[model samples]
Target: MADPPPAPWIGSVAPESVLWPGVRGTQQAAEWHNAPIDFWFLPKYAHLPHPVVPDENIGGMLTQLSATLRQRLDAVPPTPPPRRTRPGERQDNSRLKTYRTRLRPNTQQMEALRKTAGIVRWTYNRAVEYLKAHPNASFHDVREHSVTEDGLPLMNLSWVTPVLYSIREQAFFDAHTALRNGLADVRAGEIPNFELKFRKKRALFSSFRIRTRDWDGGCLKIPNFSLGPGQHQTKIQTGIDVPSLEHDGACIKQENGSWFLLWQKDMGEEKMRVPAARGPEMCAIDPGVRTFATIYDPLRGTAAKFGDGDHKRLFRLDTHLDELISGSTQASAKKKCYRMRRAANRLRARIRHLVDELHWKLRSYLKQSFDTVLLPKFNAHQMSRRGQRRIGRKTVRAMMTWAHGRFRSRLNEAMEVV
Candidate 1:
């Protein structure tokens, strides 16, 4: 309406001048890309307007504005500006903290962990099956049948004898909880129906919790495992310090042929420390599919964008992965299949890594400035529907891959949300 709020950051600034570097420019360009269709066309023409539509004198002005913005965008570097390092301070003060690191488990340890995960899955499925067959059975009945029968412990079961007793118990409890919650949701009319199904052989990742008691100084002691003492301990990625003595528990999981540990801790007396005073007091962010976020600091009348050119890279990776998947399906040899599988995994990881890196960059920006952040009332389903109908399928695909829900959640973690 009102001339689209006079183009956030470009009001009186000459097009020839360099504004804020990478992130800000890329995001502003994203806004420019949508300006014609969203702001001008629908309102003025009531139809999709061509890029160079002939409208009275306004058309020429729009053309010049578009060209100048393009030239400015081309002059700016593609890569986002380097992150400014913060001076040493107590940054991590959350009461509960989670530390994640890539696990470097030797062949023996990997085999052991794999076996332990299998056993856990088996225990979970067994419990669920029992519950389904005996719908009125209590959790105790399910637990007793799963962990023990006739005074014989789970260890007596050949399949469960290899791993620690606690792991199996944890899996059985998890299964019972899931079934109970599902039933509750069905009764509450929150879900149309529920079904208990077994974990398939193929899964995105396999994970099981290791009790604190099971650890022998980094090493997980599994019965009859070949490795002895230190030889079986999974090593964390270099430079990450795991709080050996204070960690509450650990979950080990395998992701795309790589192992990782999610270590948890309770920060007994630590609390959230106030972030140093910097930047603006508050900023309103318009999260988008093409741009990570377009942020406007009303007090300063300045705008900046956060996401680097990650969506483009993600699309390329997605296409490459699709090709790899197609090739893998047609391959007859084991070697080809293995190679394709590895390539696909690498692609998936890269896509995931890019999104995570963008989120962290956003979080860092929030922490360093803007004491209070405001996010629009987002309805993802409605957005998707409107985007597909108005913007086309390609735009809708990007919207879906934006991981907006995850982005919002990470923002919540970083600061107070309004």
Candidate 2:
């Protein structure tokens, strides 16, 4: 029977089947992580050979391709650089939220991210130096910064290091490529500045690894990277719509410090078709100090208020703890304050969860009572300013910390017609 189907190729076999001889059974069966490998077509490189094409040929094509891209960008208009805004003048909540997220990264990850940032900065400076020296020549005519390997120009870098072989390398290359293109545009008088100043700030870890087959067409194996020893591995497969230099997935940390690769499959927007309808029904949301949210339903002619007394109590306790922390001289007292602070954070998370549930209930009521919902575009910052004048500044700031914008966004997303 064709030599028993060549001992049932484990890699090719369905994850559900019983483990065959010489095949290792994974900790989990048939997860999204252990799915089959697939390829996506890159629109920009559709006419060119596949990524799996021979290294020498790929290098030659990429060199010519880079030149063509540089020329095209030179013809296009460059975008104007962003202007620096005063600290108080920046009103965008999205920007503020992004700033808040930056505070979440640990020390180690933050350090790594900073190193990459430095690399980018160095690359930009070098590129500028090159451009300045050769003012007469076009950027398209400029050669790449070459590195030597074994006394020869390192054209084929894929074999040298796994990091070089990764999608992260591609992303680094693409970022520099785009910057070069932008510079070219500026040089041609297509737009304003030849340089865009990137602000130094914390950035998320964008690149991660996943297990895949070897470069020499060998059996499937893990790539050379440090994962915790004896850790169960999960492979996640994701789809790509737009061309990307990074894998569309993540390696999630488990309780035992093990990581499972979470592949982001189907990276495309779900086409949402909303049926034609009249204007949304009027629903007044009053966010106040007494209550978290007060819903005035016009359809039912009723007002419902949701309060978080427990959260308020926790907040008060935290305030007392803070006072104790400030006054205390002993180390143990400071430790006690830290514990209280941790408890306060947990309580805050719970309060947020409760708020989300309340919003969900309000949405359900709206769906049943009316065809649509109408809410006043409440500017939390403006409201906070008003509150500061009326109430105390500390009280207004506390209210702002509750994230009224986030609450409003959640409501909009839940109630929006799609």
Best by TM-score: 1
lDDT per residue (tens digit) for residues 57-138 in model 1? 6445545644554454345345545432222212343456677777777677777778778888888888888888987787
Give the Cα error of residue 103 in candidate 1, in Å.
1.4
Q: Which tens-of-lDDT digit does each residue in 264-313 have in candidate 2?
A: 22222232211212333344455665455555443333444454332364
Q: Estimate each model's TM-score.
A: 0.65, 0.39
lDDT of each: 0.62, 0.39
Pairs that collide in candidate 1 are: none
For model 2, the superposed segments whose C-alpha errors exceed 4 Å read 1-160, 170-222, 226-233, 236-271, 274-282, 308-370, 385-389
TM-score of model 1 (CA atoms): 0.65
- Model 2 scores a C-alpha lDDT of 0.39
